[model samples]
Target: MEDEVLLTLMIEDLLAAEGFDTISAAHETEAMAHAAAAADRIAVAVVNLHLGRDVAGQRVIRALRQHVPNLPVVVITGFDSEAPQADLRGLGGPTVRLHKPGGYDELVPAVLNVMKQVRTGAWPEEGRRKTDYNV
Candidate 1:
């Protein structure tokens, strides 16, 4: 889920152009609602790590994981998903992160990468780095 309207619209249009059925959510509650309604159809999720001032996207990710245990996540954030000295490893399932502002081209690839990991059962591997979120 992304809080930025322009970015969300850009992403929605871009993904739609690529023939993806898009679902957009701006915050935790909306994310949960959409996930609940379309969990089975949601093949992957692209979330903004900070929805507004809080790291609410993390909550969305966790909730999505609880709902769809092995759901692949594509986390887009301005800061590092693996911040220095930060520890949030059990964040759940196959995941990916892409630095924001100019990584539009990487979106599809990152999503595809995580989906492949799910398909091949390669994620949640031991000793994998946190930034290993993205391909």
Candidate 2:
């Protein structure tokens, strides 16, 4: 999830056009709430690594993962060189990292690839039955 309102809307619209329903969150709380609420329906999360106002994207990723352990994450960061790539890698599960500014072009493809992995059972337990719950 992205914190920038305009960017978040743009990404949501793009994904919607691609026939995927998206849940956008501006910060950690909202992201966690949405993820917990729609844990079963959500297939993946595209998160911005730097959410303005000192909210680190890793927090969002960790919170989301708590609900959907096998969820695939596509991390978009403008601070590619400075970002904590090791920390992200440490988060584990299926992940794809894309550098920002031009990374928008890769977002869709990265999501598609992750989904492909889920569908092919490369990401085990991803499609297993899950109960739907509201937060």
Tell me, by lDDT, which candidate is best: 1
Clash pairs, candidate 1, are 1-47, 96-133
Each prediction's number of clashing residue pairs: 2, 1
Task: Give the best candidate by TM-score.
Answer: 1
> lDDT per prediction?
0.78, 0.75
**lDDT, residue 5, model 1:** 94
Tens-digit lDDT track of model 2 for 1-135: 898888888899889989999888887777778877988888899988777675467777777788887678888887754445424644555777788778888788999987787667575444332321111
Off by over 4 Å in 2: 121-135
Per-residue C-alpha lDDT of model 1 across residues 1-135, encoded as one tens digit per residue: 889999999889877877889989887788889978888788889988778666777778777777788888888878764674123356766877678877777998888899998999887566666654432
State the lDDT at 79 in candidate 2: 70
